[model samples]
Target chain A: MNEKKLKSILEKIHDKNYDCMILTQFNNIRYISNYAPTSFAICLLKDDPIILTSSMDKELAEKTSEIPVEEFKSFNELKKLFEKDNFKKIAIESSISISLFRKIEGNWDLNIEDFLEKERMIKSKDEITKLEKAAGISHKSFKELNPMKKREDGFTEWELAYELGYLLRKNGAEKESFETIIATGTNSSLPHARTQNKKLQTPILMDWGCKAEGYCSDTTRTFVYSEKQEEIFDIVFEAHNKAIKSVKAGIKSCEIDKIARSIISEYGYEKNFIHSTGHSLGLDIHEIPSISKKDETILEKNMVITIEPGIYLEGNFGVRIEDTIIVGKNKAEIIGNLPYSI
Target chain B: MNEKKLKSILEKIHDKNYDCMILTQFNNIRYISNYAPTSFAICLLKDDPIILTSSMDKELAEKTSEIPVEEFKSFNELKKLFEKDNFKKIAIESSISISLFRKIEGNWDLNIEDFLEKERMIKSKDEITKLEKAAGISHKSFKELNPMKKREDGFTEWELAYELGYLLRKNGAEKESFETIIATGTNSSLPHARTQNKKLQTPILMDWGCKAEGYCSDTTRTFVYSEKQEEIFDIVFEAHNKAIKSVKAGIKSCEIDKIARSIISEYGYEKNFIHSTGHSLGLDIHEIPSISKKDETILEKNMVITIEPGIYLEGNFGVRIEDTIIVGKNKAEIIGNLPYSI
Candidate 1:
């Protein structure tokens, strides 16, 4: 995978008219070189790739990375490796911070490139298989979770989130892809509400995911109670189901988003739908070519995405139904075999 | 707390000869304005300080923030707020990304300022109270965790970390301060080893923390067995104990690091002591005035920092001991009362 990714990156560098591409983002390095450093590590992709890792990370980097790893002495030593005038144009990741950019910008013609991101958008069969395995673990864990037992015991929101994390890991995940959201009652009204220290309320919304083999899986399930809660839940379920149903090769990502939004709009709760219907997921929990209102990326086979449409009524309650889907020729195949209804 | 912090910031800004300061880093905004945003948020420090949060964050911002919150429309709107002649030099956080810096560069003269970091290094009485609460929750949760039960039942390394997270929340923490590290046995050889989906091993190194009311707590404990493990453990414990003892108001941060390093060196394992002795923790997991070889900042009263020292032998095992401490007149007050021997 490292050699394949490196070859593609080298090809991209040549095609994009750059002498070298410098990767500072840890994940980018891990994606291309398989050495994810615990401390600072940089990968300079030239004719021959080299990973510059701190002395602390040298041993691990050398052990894991496909490329040769060297202990980084200083920036001056790194600068000297390249010719002062010949290696002028260098590509940098867009996420490089100002302080780092300031330090390295004095010599090179730095250009922010989305080369890695663009390449990462399309998943290989092996990558998709890892993602499916992650989704499988998350789904299986959710089934094993006795929410009713917690409901009877009156568990706090964070406790349930934490319990779910434990289950995911127990079911063969490295860790949660992102912070598990277990917002209950009115707290769920905030789209990204922090878990409160209170006991579980009438309705609970959980947005969670887990990491397996560096791949990610994301899912959201909202437990409802009252008639009003059930009413909102039904609308969200329709949007989620239809959005997934509409996903296929050649279909625009925004079109699927519109389908979900239009369903909620027809139910007279358009404004209540706060965020996008879905987003692509891979190494990162949230990745490029999201299923938002503006995204025009054409859905292709092996493109995994989520269809999570939520209805949030501030200071009251909210409901969201989400699922991961792998784009297919006719219709996207939902990764998990779990039932949507609780 | 927000008012007091803002007043100090206002005075600092004036003293630094700046009319307004641009706060881009999220934690800095939370420190001064009392709103830790879910998405993007910015603060423009002027006579009447205001926060510009994304539309998605407006509801939460309004509910949580002490300061006035407004919708962030565009960068052009920010340009309009600043009169080019009135504010010649605008101070920005050193941590702000180069991408954001480039976007706002055309608007004004930007100067990287450690304004917030310097002020945040010395914790207030109220801030220390929150840190103490966070530390208390973490220590209590660890004590309550039964690794034997988890391991006997075939729980993975990530499962143990997740269980601790749940317990922390149950004991009244907002969330885990950062990603919990639960590396077991051979995997623990890597200082920053991420949790894997494997069963328990001989020596386990768990570094975990929890956040309470925005303040963070950090702790690391290495469970060891074998003769080699016992030997490494002895060296790490001596370094950890001596480092904590050296933390006092009048001493330099580097002196504390040397205390830790010298002990490991005396045992002929200086090269294996990979990372820093410690780092200040509050709001952010790794904060300013780091206890490292290059840092010259003097330990000040009320400064809460961690004293973590470790020894790693590749493909063998690693041992690390960590604790949070508050600098006092002649000594340091350890936050959590958990016994080192478990």
Candidate 2:
């Protein structure tokens, strides 16, 4: 099923004078072989892909992978195999650890390549379906938890986070896409806040998602109480709305970020919006082509991304609104029906 | 204070003619500065250490980090700073990404160094106390879970895993050290099996842990139902007990592995044991000085590690027993008072 994707990557490697590509990221491997390793595994994408996985994972890999599976012995052994095969060039993912890079270094040329990233950027119909399903499950779970009512009840941030996770799984999600962020009151000022044991406070912020069939969904909402909190929330919500409206197939990812950032800046809260406006998400929550000032990747049809705009007053409180959307020919398609200011 | 730890690392770097070390691993940073990063951040160690964190993390980092904190702009700026400092040799952790390694490659001599790993190998009294508490909390939570009774009641692996996590938080734990593995019946054959929605079956193998005060505690226990399952369970328990008994200061780590492997081999189940005997744990669950045939590091006092011996029969069932222990001069002190079988 991934023949087209593997062929595309192989052609890129060949054009770059590389014999094969070494893929270690679980999502990258899964995209090719339909087997996401639970431990160390390498996918050698060449004329015919082969996966070398730990012995503990050998059985699962064999049962699920479209490619041939082998039990990994050592880097020394893999280096010898490459030498024996007389492979002239090897392309490795930029995410490879220096330790592994050093271990696999040989006489052959080895360099970082983004062939897999380029291949995985555009979502297929099957992948998009999974993404929508994951988003649906997340929305259903969030609604069931009812943050508006939960905010009044005294419950620690972690307790509510756990309840959301339980609800997500019950709604048919495989697992949480990432750690549920249940930052409350002043803690919400940190974009990536750790869930605490403190009871619920005003301006509750929760950024949570779930996985369905190896696809991820990301969403964030802030429940405001005070007049100031509501005012900040309105500004963030405006930015989030405008950014989503600006997404299209031909526009640059950074352009979308600029749209949201400019909206926040208009209200003198530009500096407070700390992180990127959004990021691409698929099997992994944080993918390439981030909606950031530094990124200039052109948005493509079927590309999934999140637009999260926030205003954080250091040591005071923060308000954020986020939603996942899909790039379209003319307009962006938001993933779920979750309210912006829930 | 981490003054002594910092001194040790600086002395090692000085011996290697390195001016400063760039560290990004959250645990290593936390060990030195008492501040664990929630997002992208870097700790530069020299005569004076400074942490360059994302703007979103600067407020928390400044409050928690013992060292100075600065907002990170870009790698180009960092490289310019390194050049201005006239650094002759710069040290980096082996775990650094090839992407980051390429970003800061400059006129200065850049090389992989293990100063942080070497410094973190030995635990302090406070770290050990935290580890003990984490282990105590994990044991208490597991006992309260009453897995034996849960086995009788019909509940999916994911459901029970969620409940265990809830109990872990209730008893006092920052979070799970790693993903809780709740494998049951045939799924137990895969050592690192994913927690599934399938109901609990015969021979439930759970490998779970929790974090307390940034320290980790790992343990595993298999509840067996059938005669063959009990037989395998007995052999694994014996190997686990013997391995724990063999742990002490001044012995090679491989020697302990040999002891465990020899027993499993005598029982004709050596091939069934796929992974290492155990691994060291501190802020991170898997640390260096692994109890494996290839690792020959000498055990030292104040080192915390786990002794887990498991046997997996593919397509059938698996059993494992694990415990965390502290290496003393002439003995090993097991972390908690959990029973081998329940």
Candidate 3:
């Protein structure tokens, strides 16, 4: 439990003139209380924060939570607590479900804020360590799998995904950070293509990750074959490299996005890059400060983000090169030593 | 989709006086449109229902959706479509984020409803077949793993979990429906205990599942060792058996829960039954019409639910037995032939 982080959050609530904030997201509650609920639970962030968990979770919460814990009965009971605290202006996460919001939406000024997300943007030294370990295990497992050999063996995309998942667990990672994407041939054109049972094909785009101590690592590597595929791969590689080079403590996230987008544009594939350049990663696979056109979040030291740039040609193949990096004083440092080309 | 299902949903919307419904949940969208969005997408349920997907999903949506598809540009553009349709009342799923709800909130009467859930509660013949296949694959994989032998080899909980996952994929499962719980020894007391790196111990409690063609299957089995463990296991097994025996078309969900709870209570361990008796499983691992003390939903024919009864003794070993069952006109039919005692 980081007391400093809790104090900082309380100070932010005070600054916003909010008496308290309620967090229902599992990751958010885990971030503050060190107890991730298997089912519904809520963490009330205040001077003295308390986690109200379901009856089934009480034992685990009591054992694991850093703060005080209690059994949550109903929304009315929670509302009684707010009234007891004389909280007129309450803060709620933007991600709170509409149904939940409606249950307790009366006689109060409920402001939607990203208080926890803003705090989680910058990774601490401990968090960076976990991310590094996660990246290390992921890269190690990928090398152990020898995807090229598996492809030569005529393994299906889903088979490769399952094997990679097995390797990650064997290499001391909790699990995959997200669904392992092993898109091949024309299927690579779809950014979030589901792994198919079909045999491996040309231009394999494998975007995979693993979790270590709750932190997440994400990386993408495309194995190009044809000359046309190599051409697109080169453009994506250049974009990915420049995006990382553009990351610094004082730059806006969008500037870094521009660095990647403009590089792809220079090669006449700007519109082909459909998704954002990259996104931040931590306990959650996708986090705040997304590196997109509209985001103006300033990159700060200790912030960990992914710089993935791709060019997906419809009905053809695609190429994506991604690496998780930690923001430095003047630049970004990629987490793992995985090679760009296989 | 079954056109009949879509028509039923449309009829429900008309009956509720809702001009249209906006579905953001992936499963709901998939249920209605047959295209599950990998990222953010919405389905507008109307006479001529259309799915507005992101530009990145345009190709996939066009290929897979049963209904019409269009590229979603901005919230303002979507609002314009609603205005053009002259929609006076709008219905939204309760799970929509407050942030998204706020962006589209306006003069129209926005009502939160479970129209989709109500419709999905009753499974179709096709859905039942998918569920049966999912259960068969899951059970076959468990048998292939041979957990007793793995325990003899002193394998860790996580290793067994990974092996089960690999076997599930090998046996034709898309993926695990939820994180596999492979708790051993006293760790079994934690209903949702994460698989640990420690070697296998007494009283192994495994609750695992997998997906088959978007449908889910869940099952739990506890391997008891000591006399005390066996005693508790007997009580849980009796509760499980009786609960399944009590399951019929006309009974209430709570009645089934009471049958299970009372059996455990008769043995003076009612407080140890921490979580609900069971829950419905479909595309999602846990769904509506859960078999709990509070749920008063009637058990209808074609409704697929699990009958799991467990006794968790905190700081001691625990035992649980579960099986997915399809409610028939007269009684319940278990999905798989997995043995209760192993």
Candidate 4:
């Protein structure tokens, strides 16, 4: 972020009478310092921004951080720093734990603040580039997953998940955004089934992602075999398609969800559509302004989110199709080039 | 995980005047109910315990949870249920976000409580068995790695990590507890260095672990090929050994940290010993009563922790030795049988 943007954030924080802010969330820290912490790190944003990082992270922080970095010594020493500063009103991120919050709250007038989250909602050009790269890597890796080879040779669910992870990393991703889901056979009936040590079964559903330069990519594809599977697949696909088509700058996030749900409801499978239409993705796999019925946040330009719609049949199978789209002025631009149908 | 034990926990919460407790943080939920949520789940502990789980997690929750499970419709719906029950004082786990706290705080009187954490601190026989199994799988996987194999045909940091993870899963591990850290060459100097796509170098420092039955196991091995590496390794090994030896019921956790620090200080590398001596581990990779300089919590029987000590030479290399141990009545019982020296 530019100095002006950072200063603007500080000004907004000041309007809330926050003399100091504690940022522990890695992504929030990265937004200000340009250094994503590998281990534990804390940033105290006051008159002059500073980062206290673990000794192991010092080298990396020094190399990447725009702000001055210090080796974190002890919590006692950290507590003393706050005392010395005499910070009366301290602002903390919502993600800060109650345990850690109580430890620090005893000494200061700490208030929960969304100052960082508000700033992070609007993606920078560099952040967009990283997200694009992550999406590209995920898409490329998906194509490389020759499931036919595994199907013939009899590969286990976890083995396929592991192979996809390896491919994602090999394709320039730093790591997977989350655990790769490879639910197959009857296990595919569970929307979030654990991978078992068994051979891949019919109508496989794989939900996976990759991370590049700290940005995350999320996508899911379900391969159907039986006619019943195909029938459910078409409804999910239509929900996915209509949801993606409904994306625009002025539209509320929930409207996108309605577009998906309306299609599934028309098929008399509204109850079968288990999860939300989608969720915003960036440094974190799940972010705010989710495409759920209750969320009324307006979709804005540069807001990247997943458009996933699924229908699950109890004890039978499930079908889900997902894609990430970056919101543009008039419409949303899909990030990956992979086809919805395989 | 017995009904009586669960009842006691509920009584403790009631004693603290908590009408209902919202449990997130997967491990905490698993500790209360056998079910570990894959997606999202919330256990509201009151007169009648009920788990509100996402549609994706319903099947798994139903299969594993001892408590009654219901589909999570929306936050508003959950709030309505709380209102219907006339719950006035709601307790929340410390792991909950400040945003979530604020969102729910408006509905009832909120207080951060460790009612569940206190219950989890003392493990039952079944929990210990699972932990031991996790440790066994991790040890067997490490033996299979045999850093000597990498010496025969050099491997990239990530490739070695991938192999270790694969081996762990092959040996019946549920999954890796966390990302396998295989820092070698100059990268070893930084404690939490990201693995690079390059051939392995001398003085390889590998920290790896795996999960079994929801319990975690952690271990680290450093390969020394030169005199300098051996010298640093010896100091770290002494610290590691002394720390483990110091672990016993009724002893202050920080005392064990002092033992390790004293060893490194005696070797004139006090400043090089960067992080804490050890940390408690179970379902979570890092847990409470950290064996740090300031922690005054007493060690208890059946508590599992890792004793890791390291010495670093910036831009040169680093050596670290780590092992998981179970705190017994008299001494620490090493969880894994992996040799310190390689």
Question: Who wins the lDDT comparison?
Answer: 3
Tens digits of per-residue lDDT for model 3, B194-308: 8999999988899999999899999999988889998998999999999999998999999999999999999999999988999998888888899999999988999999999
**1 or 3: which has the higher TM-score?**
3
- TM-scores of the first chain across all predictions? 0.96, 0.98, 0.98, 0.95
Task: For model 2, state the Cα shift of residue A317 in Å.
Answer: 0.9
Local accuracy of candidate 4 as per-residue lDDT tens digits, B79-193 = 8888898888888888887766666655578888878776676667887888889989988888888767875687788988888888999999989998888888898988887
Q: What lDDT tens digits, residue by residue, belong to model 1 across residues B1-342?
A: 556776887898888888789897888888877889888889988778889997668889998888799999778778777764456778888777767887787645788888899899989889999999999999899989977667788887866877787788778888889888888978887888777768988787889999999999999888787888888899999998888887889999999999999999999999888888999999999998899998999889999999999998877788999999999989999886887666
Can you rank all candidates by TM-score, best first? 2, 3, 4, 1
Per-residue lDDT of candidate 1, residues A22-63 (tens digit): 898888888887787778889998778889998778878998
Query: Model 4: residues >4 Å from true position, as ranges?
Result: A1-4, A14-17, A73-89, A106-109, B14-20, B73-90, B106-109
**Tens digits of lDDT, candidate 4, A1-342:** 467668978998789888789999998898888898988899998769899998878888998999999988767788889889777889898888777776776457888887877777767788899999998998898889887688788899989988988898889999999888898888887877878999999899989998998899998899999999999999998888888888989899889999999999999999888888999888889888789998999989988999999988888888988899999888888886787666
Q: lDDT of model 2 at residue B335? A: 91
lDDT of 2 by residue, A223-325 (tens): 8989999889999989999999999999998899999999999999988999999899999999988999989999999999999989999999999899999
DockQ of each: 0.60, 0.88, 0.76, 0.71
lDDT of 2: 0.90
Query: What is the Cα-based lDDT of residue A194 in candidate 4?
Result: 79
The sequence of per-residue lDDT tens digits that candidate 3 reaches over residues A1-342 is: 677888888999999899889899999998998898988999889888899988888888999999899999889998898888888999999999999999988678999988899999989888899999999999999999998999999999999998999889889998899999999988999999999989999889999999998989999999999889888888888888878888889999999999999999998988899889899999999999999998999889999999998998988888899999999999899998899777
Backbone clashes in candidate 3 total 0
Candidate 2 clash figure, as a count: 0
Which residue window of length 10 is worst by lDDT in model 1 chain B?
Answer: B80-89
Top model number, DockQ: 2
Local error of candidate 2 at residue A6 (angstroms): 2.0
Comparison by TM-score, 1 against 4, better one: 4
